[model samples]
Target: MVTPAVSGGDLARVAIVGASLGGMSTASGLRGHGFDGEIVMVEAEAELPPDRPPLSKQVLTGEWPLERARQPGSATLDELGVDLRFGRRAVRLDVATRTLTLDDHETVSADAVVLATGSAARRPPIPGIDRPGVHLLRTGADAAALRAGLAATPQRVLIVGAGFIGLEVAGSARELGLPVTVVEAFATPASRVLPPAIGMALAAAAVDAGVDLRTDTSVEALLGPGVEGAAGGDGDAPVAGALLSDGTTLAADLVLVAVGAVPASGWLSDTPGIDLDDGVLADATAMAAPGVAVVGDLARWWHRGAGGFVRVEHWDNAIEMGRYVGARLMARDDAEPYTPVPWMWSNQFGAKFQLAGHVSPDDALTWIDGTPEDRAWVGVTHDGTTVKSVMGYNRNPKVMRIRMRMDGPDGLALVDLLAAESTQ
Candidate 1:
């Protein structure tokens, strides 16, 4: 059992940065844990933070209204006695004093501070990237702009990455009958997360859906209009296409750069004692300092299961970490190390892909229920002994059950259990 970092009674006020899903979750968890202290949430965006998962699918496809993507409204936070500070960005932090300097030059000092600044979309240092018609989807504004761009009906849609976001957007584009081309630097789509076999199987579905999936390809540069053979723009105007490393140029009226994101930890660069290596470093208890806790994508904390520190940017991780840190701060739950089986899901080509627990490309994967060719399967990955992760495509029930077992002793005996079930 880990010891609580700060007692509930000692916390007179708590200041949360980002107002992201994780930040909001922390605030709500504190209130739910009976913390009557003042709760202040400072967000860089003036409007309420919107749910991001929908931005790629429903929001992009115009199936869901943009207003429906909002997580919790001001009224909801107000009911919990939260002091919502919208449009206020934290520019600096003094961990020792538990004071945060906002971009507006206002200093907010609290008994405890929670860092949930999250991440920002990574825009590669390529020329013509700043031009119109080239978009990076991270925020609600980005989604709206991309959606509007799609409404304009570009002849060719080019996505510069085969990550979840890029693939989901590709599926959405295809659903609108637009010609989509996805370029991935890796051999498979979502190679950073999914194993090659699984990614290739999903890539087949995208191809079947009329997406021109290009693997092992990279975008050298975004070609602006007036370039030789560039389409859809006048001289020196919006992005007309891209120059690939293979010496091939693809004409794209619209380009979505979904390469990846980086932790929003630049403000804490000068802050002493806070280790900033890719993200804000924290202990297994999610505590960064005596009264400081870091949650969400910005937290790079020790994972007992992984045997090292990991920074998870998934939506579920944000919620779980927020609740755990909140309970720890208030001393509400047993002092247990924050160890969670990281889970993430994506929707593409009308199939739901779910992955639970940390997985590596090198992990040995075995199909437990169905084959990948079926486009609906449940598989588990193992490190020669214990199961490390479970992934499924449209097999939610089996995948979830296996995922739940991963936290128990049965997880280690999964192979034997599956063998036994197979004989029956």
Candidate 2:
């Protein structure tokens, strides 16, 4: 809880650009906190924003209907008296005026503004990426299109990148009994985030689940029908396969590019006084500029715990940061700085992996309970003293308990965590 620089009573209208989870949470929080300001939510999509986690799992596998993926609908926002402006894209923002310029040339002025535009899936410059058969999953439309592609029963599925999104899609494809091949540039899956040992453990799980996990590989180019060594051309033919860096060709009717995501901060490129180094740079309180705050994937805020700036794309971070910003706007006095232990979960190959706190490959990883080979295990990441993060597979109860203990300022020590586990 941080005291907002601007007084809540002085705010007559608060405009939230992008009706994403973070945006919606801020609106709900402002109203819940007894601020009687006008809330106008602008969304690019016509339909209400849907939950993204299911897009890679249940939604992609057709296990859950598309409707189940939807978050709070219009009725819920209406009850909160939120002026939902759908099908309008925000084009620019004038931080000085706290005004937003929509693509339709409509201007929205507010006393305070919240930017929760979120992020867009990255489609690497690999040729033929825009081909009809290729896909990127970041929005409801992307998920729907990928779902339709999966329904087509392609003979083989090729996925680029072995991050959480790519791996989740691979898991879903496996559930559908489809042959899947995954290519990752790292030596192991999720090496950028997790330690090599943990990545190898996850890689082993994927391999055991029948995924053609190809590590240390990159896609040189995507191939089209009858196009030898050349990427797709002007013709609208779908992608047929991909040529790997190893000079090998893989036949895959459907290609999913899940490399990563880029913050949707392009609209603010020309906006002065706002830092956009990979994302909108903000202070610990999540404030970017006067009367303007950013949340969700678009926010790369300073993390007091990490001693630096970090942009977390986890669903939990979005909700927590949104609520924090919302409450901060209504606060009258100073409160604690926003220092949250990040948390994220993933479902793949019927195993649930949960990670809490910020983890770095440089951190010392020590398995506390069981080894990675076990069905249930827990690992602690620390800088030889204080615990930095905790990761677990199929052990939710223990992982969540340890995660809670990490909330304090001086976080739980590694010795204490291990001692507590030993006593258990």
Candidate 3:
């Protein structure tokens, strides 16, 4: 763990932008670590930060109320003495002066700033993407609207991307008895995150679960009856269907564009010393600039294990990064580099898929137990016999054990570890 030199000062007030999971967690962490200074958490949303993992599963399925997803609830924030500023947006950040400007034309001078603005859903460059009935899941309102839209029991749902969010929504939609059709530009689902073999296996599961999973496909345009075409001049006509690149049209009563996400770094444009390529580029300790730290989905920080700067957009990443940055900010000495074994899970078709460590396309994948067809398998991914990532479907403990072994002093080999486990 490499520790960077952080300056010493009064460290009076810490202003955290974007009061989501990362922001809330940082606030709690600071208070937990004996930071008596003022903690101001700014959020553009009117409501408190809510747990987002359940949005695609329970909330969307109506099994859990939206309020159940609220994190660091108002009571908790009050108990922590956090100056929670709801409906206030941070519009500008000047790292040199260590000042943050809000949308209401107010400026806050802080000893340090934590930019946890997170990321927003990325939509494709298709025509009529802004049309009604096209939805994105990023905020509480977005989830509410999507939930309400699904309550009517739409006939067909067209999910634009085969990512985790898309698959989770598909699972919810399937449980609701709505026909689902997924279109992806890649050959396999979730190829960007999981191994190609595992991605194809998940695609097979989708098919078995009655999902029309279409790969190597692209949505060129979104069509709807509107003022330009409909006779009644109803521009608010619901989304009719989508035009694909292969000259095919798929009818869709609702469309979820879950392509990906980009950092909400527009406000940090004028802020010097901050890299905004995929996200706010931070050092190994999650520091973007002096007295400025970024976390959550919008932080592209250096990872010692990956040997490069990586951006992770999972719930665990947000919590872990927020806590690490908070601890480092208040630590008396230079803190350790923030390196977490990246982990995430997706629940679809009543099956839970857990993955830990890093898995890249270049890594060699070997099945350790079970089979993808059974939806109950454990797999190990290796980079030239050095285990990189362990994946499991409904076998979290197995993957976790493998992840722990990888972190051991003697860098364990996948084959040797599996062989040893077999003997036990």
Tell me, by lDDT, which candidate is best: 2
Clash pairs for candidate 3 = 51-69
| Tens-digit lDDT string for candidate 1 (338-419) | 8899899999999999999888887888888788889899888887788889999999987887778787633556667488
Write candidate 2's Cα lDDT for 1-424 as tens digits. Answer: 2324464688788889888888988887787788887888899999788899999999998989878987643358767888889999989888888898999899999988899999999878998887888999988888999999999999999999999999999999999999999999989888889999889888988999999999999998888886567664454688988889898888889999999999999888868978899999988888888788899999998889999999999998888888888887777436356899899999989999999999987678999888878867899999889999999999999899999999897899988988888887
Q: Alpha carbon lDDT of residue 194, candidate 1?
A: 77
lDDT per residue for candidate 3 within 158-265, as digits (tens), equals 999999899999999999999999999998988777778899888988999999999999988777853233221343567878888787877787899999888898
Q: What is the C-alpha lDDT of each candidate?
A: 0.86, 0.88, 0.83
Separately for all candidates shown, the number of backbone clashes (residues 3 or more apart, or on different chains) is 1, 0, 1
TM-score computed on alpha carbons, candidate 1 = 0.95
Give the lDDT of residue 241 in candidate 1.
Answer: 86
Candidate 1 local distance difference test against the native: 0.86
TM-score of every candidate: 0.95, 0.97, 0.94
lDDT score for residue 299 of model 2: 94
Name the candidate, 2 or 3, with the larger TM-score value.
2
Looking at candidate 1, the ten consecutive residues that score lowest on lDDT are 226-235
Task: State the TM-score for model 3.
Answer: 0.94
After TM-score superposition, what is the CA distance of residue 268 in candidate 1 from its true location, in Å? 0.7
